[model samples]
Target chain A: MITEGRAWKFGDNIDTDVIIPARYLVTTDTKELGKHCMEGVDAGFSKKVRPGDMIVTGENFGCGSSREHAPMAIKGAGIACVVAESFARIFFRNALNMGLAIFEVPGISGGIQDGDRVSVKHDTGEIIDHTNGRRFFAAPLPPFMQEIIKAGGLMPHVLRKIRG
Target chain B: MGQTITEKILAAHAGRDVVVPGEIINVRIDIALANDITAPIAIELLEAANIPSVFDREKIVLVPDHYVPNKDSRSAEQVQIMRRFARKHDIRYFFELGEMGIEHALLPEQGLVLPGDVVIGADSHTCTYGALGAFATGVGSTDIAAAMITGETWFKVPESIKFTYKGKPQKWVTGKDLILYTIGDIGVAGARYKAMEFDGEAIEALPMADRMTMANMAIEAGAKSGIIAPDQVTVDYVSRRAKRAFELYVSDSDAAYVDSKSYDVSEIEPQVAFPYLPENTRPVSGAGTVPIDQVVIGSCTNGRIDDLRLAARVLKGQTIDRNVRLIVIPATPTVYRQAMAEGLLETFLAAGGIVSPPTCGPCLGGFMGVLGPGERAVATTNRNFVGRMGHPTSEVYLTNPAVAAASAVLGRIGSPEEL
Candidate 1:
């Protein structure tokens, strides 16, 4: 699973309230949530973000609230993946459960600027900044987590397990 | 190797003699909880998976406290979904509006959780049960669905951070102040993916309500859980309300920790978190006269009977500023009844405050007391993220009940000493 995209950068502590505010939480429809994604922080985010764009952020991205809407919205918006310096624990798990690929690369945000073309090799955990010809490595996901993501999130993974 | 309290609890649940940090393991769950907001989504996922039945209906607890009284057709529909799922699964602990409180506060009071149990909830503040010496944490709706199907979930044993407090608290300084100070000291992500073990003489001496307040906000620091060893105080608190036997586990004296910090409580002052970030804290004396339009005192953080008594003591005879609107909500119906019986509700009403039912209404901007553009509020609820209460332009200051009451009277940030 390799992903190639341009980067959209944000700062630290980008909370769930800013990702998709509680006002839009009336429904669990991922597409509707994607329409309002990042509107709290950047009003034009939904309109401007293109499919296959990657989000890069400073430390502690996705903090506050255990709502899966934040990651679900990001995934539904056609964003390929999120690379952060760190993540709030629940957000990290939620992203995995929703099959939204996320990677933790310390100092990764400092090296890449917004709109920089980048490619990620999920299997090898290699991040390549095409704009600058620089490469960074993130720890590979564990075998079981990789399988869960491949199965398209937890529900599918569990269903497959039960069927087997 | 000596095991930390968190390791001990997780190992016990995993049916292992020992476990270490950073190792992924599957553990049996004792209690699984979901509120109105998360339960609907979990139920949807469960139906999508085509699972015939829940692993154990008796172990699941559902509560609809987020947008209770049917704020809108959508929220009402959400609650209906949870109700249908509860009935379909024969869930034993389904709580309706009248019987419900905030899940965090209600679970321990009803004795559904016990010491050394592994608890999980779809809401982030589920870590609040760690106050009872349980290995509790929060997960997402899909994870909750998986747990509903299998009665077990996976976890990575987290590294532990030890916080030791000494001496005694000063007047008007409470658990709220201590937690604010700790979050300020360690930035919002300081304890990411780690277990926070709170110890020291001052912490143990704190009452159960205050300890609950401290443990409730551990998620604010990005901690997986916050815990205190069960002592005589825990035993006394649990024996009165608990229905069944429970196991108690303590950390070995030689247990290892990733990091440690200590503070003297006597030297600490009342604290507050500024707008948009729980980590942006300042001593109350230096908080200045930041005017406020509203003051809220409720939520799982500090919405107990004792928290109400503290606010009532500050607002006994004085009225709030005409420009200010004070909203005081008890966490549960039982807490509401106790406050009314103790005259706390009457005191709030007499002081120009509005007392509402036991709902999480204003805390998460669901309804009841949402702020308008450019309005500012001082609240006792956890999390002060931008637009948490209402408009993106509106601001919230996080503090304790006493400070919220005093600020309501002054129409600005102030302390009980000013009264």
Candidate 2:
């Protein structure tokens, strides 16, 4: 699967509380969560983000708090994918479980800047910076994890297994 | 290859002879925990998957301590849904409001977790049980749903980082300070996807409470889990409360580690994490007089009996600043009862502080003393990310119980020595 989008860059250690504050966790509605995505760190994030936009960040993205809401909000806000130097363990799993594509490419942040046109190939683990004509590679997801992403997250993945 | 303690625990749970980092393996879960906030969504996912019943009701534990006492109609509905599900499924470990406590703190105290077990919870602090020598980690609700249906989950055996502490901690410097200093030394992402295996003479000398405090914040440094090898101290603590016999495991002497570091605690001072990230730490002596609107001394991190005793000792015969509101919350009802029995609660009350029952309270900004806009707080809870305690403009400084109590008295960031 290939995804193309504009990049939105952030610094290192963007915690879950910055992605979605704990106060907005009262509801499980994806839209409600998306509405407040990145409110803590960037007040205009939700309003400015467009569908198919990608998030690029430095290391330890989604570092604090184990709330799955962080990734849910990122996915809900119509982000096509997230490319980070690294991710907190729980956030990495949560993003994939919620059907959001994420990639870890060393120095990926240095290659992309805010609003740069970028394309990602999930199958090949390649990230292309269209604006700067730069190419980078990310570690490909393992087969089983790719299967879950293809099924639109863990719930559906489990459901498919149950049916089979 | 010889295995680290984490690999050993996972190998045992997976029924394998050996395991290695980056290898995916399925393992049976000894315990699956969820609190009110995460359980409702997990229940929905479970129903969506068309799973009629849980794999083992007895292994599932639900605690509704996040917004307990029904903070609002929506929260009340959420808790009610979990309550109904627990009752219908006959999950033996469900704890209602009166018996409810923060899942991380209450689980071990209730003997729901044992040594060498593979545990997962919907909350991040679930890693706290690693102090008991368990391979416990946090997962999302959908993962919990999958675990509920199958009684097992998959894990990529993680690389391990070894932390060795030497000498002794100074007075009023506790595990909270040590862990804070460690996180500061290693950036927030230092141990991503790795086990933080804590060892050393100083670690062995730490009390169970301090161990829990350290383990509780492992997630803050992006660790999969923070673990300590089971020793006589751990044995004494777990055997007295564990309902069943448990196996103890330790790392092999030749176990490989991705990285290792050593610290001398006698040279370390009390530490505090500044706002926005836990890694932004500075010693209390140099933290300057950053005035605070509130001081919270509780949470799964440093909310035990010893934590209360430390705070009470600092607050004895001293009243907190009138401008600052100090909120003390016990992590569990058992801890609360013990504090009350020992007059800790009375001392807090006398010091112009509000003592609350066992609840997560303002730790996650759920309720109970939410800060106003631009307000700053010094708290004993883990995590001080942007807007963690209240409004988006609010800030929180993370510190130990001694610093929190002393800061409350001085109306600024202070230490126990100032008291």
Candidate 3:
């Protein structure tokens, strides 16, 4: 699957604490969560985002806590993919397991500016920044993960696996 | 091949000789835990599972610590749900307010965890027990419920990272700061999918409480758990608190480590995380004086007797700023008693600081210590993310107990030495 969007920039260590504050952890509804996404760090973030927009961040994105709400809120907010220098392990796995597109592009922070358009493929490592006309390499998703992403998250994937 | 502590525990629970990293396997859980905030959701999930009873009622530990004594009607309802669940499931370890502390502290102090066990709790700080040589990790409510019904959960054996501290810390530098420095060096996720083993002279020289603080934040760094080889201090601690004996083992010299790093303890300094995130930390001196509305000296990360004593020492005979509200919470009931015995509570009370019953209260922003819009606090709790303590507009600055106490006196975020 291909996704393209304008970029929303965040610096290093954009933790789950900032992505979705602990106060909103009471609900599991992604839409309710998306409204609060990044509201802690930037109160207007939810209002500024549009469908298919991407987030580009510095190293150590999604650090602190294994709150599943973080990625759910981001994906629910209609972000296409998050390109970061690095990702916290649980967040990385959880994001991938949930089929949320995240690219680990070291030093990619300097390459993109806010409002730049970018494109990504879930299976391929191809990432295209149309605004700057810059291309970056990313690790390719494994075949199994492709299925998981296509199925739309771990729950559906697990359901399919169990049914089979 | 030599097996590390995590590997050994995973193998034992898997009923296999050895388990490799990145491979997922379902293993039997020796214990399952939940605090008041999580127990309700976990119980709901448990009911959804349609299990007549928990796998082993004795294995489930419930504590109403987050908002014990009930912060508000909503919080009280959550506690009541947990209480009912515990009663129906025959969970004998349901701890009430005056009887509770932070779940992590109370578990180890009450002899509930032992070496080489696989334990899971709904609270992220559950990883704290790994300091005692148990392979414990935190999970969500559903996972905890699954464990309650089946006594099993899936885990991907994480790779191991070894950190060695070379020298003694300078005066005023603490294990709390060392953890911050290490997190800075590692960039928050360097130890992802890994178990970090703290070794070398510096960690050995530190007290068990400080070691627990170190192990506690390992999760923040994307580690499976952080552990230090249980030494004489560990043995003494277990002997004093636990009725049964535990066999603690150090990782073999040849144990495999996916990554290894070392630090100079003497170079470490007091660290502070600004209004944004825990990992966005700088040395305390680098951060200019920051205005504060409150100072909190408690949480699973920093609420202990040593932490309280340090804060009390700073507060003794010194009045806090009229604008500042300094709050202290002991990690457990035992720590509260110890502090009371030592006159620390009296000192704090005299200083105009409120001492709350031990719970995750302010840390998870569950009930107590909710910051209002535009309010800023210098807190010893982990994760200073904006709105983490309460209102989305409120800002939390993370620091150690000493700095928190000093900030309370100054009515702003400042280092202890500055005071």
Please report the candidate that would top DockQ against the real structure: 1
- Each prediction's DockQ against the real complex: 0.84, 0.79, 0.31
Q: What are the per-residue Cα lDDT tens digits for candidate 1 across B1-419?
A: 79998999999889999998999999999999998888888999888767799999889999998999779999999999999999988999999988899888899888898899899999999989888888899998988999999899999999999999999999989989999999999989989999999999999998888888998999999999999899988888898888777999999999999999999999888898998899999989999989999999999999998899999999999999999999999998899999999999999999999998888888888899999999999999998898999999999999999999999999899998987
For candidate 2, lDDT tens digit of each residue in B111-190?
Answer: 88988999999999998999988989999888898899889899999999999999988988899998999999997888
Docking class of 2: medium
Pairs that collide, model 3: none
lDDT of 1: 0.91
lDDT of 3 by residue, B152-223 (tens): 877878888999998888766777888877877785566766888888999888887788888888876777
Q: Where in model 1 is the C-alpha error above 4 Å?
A: none
Model 1 chain A scores worst on lDDT over the 10 consecutive residues at A43-52
TM-score of the second chain of model 1 compared to its true counterpart = 0.99
Give the runs in model 2 whose Cα sits over 4 Å from its true position.
none
Off by over 4 Å in 3: A1-11, A28-30, A44-58, A75-86, A92-164, B67-69, B243-245, B279-288, B372-375, B391-395, B412-419
- Which residue pairs come into collision in candidate 1? none
Give the better candidate number (2 or 3) by lDDT: 2
lDDT of 2 by residue, A49-163 (tens): 8867899999888887667878888877888889999888898998889877899998987899899999998878899999999999998888988888889888888777877
lDDT of 2 at B212: 87
TM-score of each: 0.98, 0.98, 0.85
Model 2 lDDT at residue B81? 81
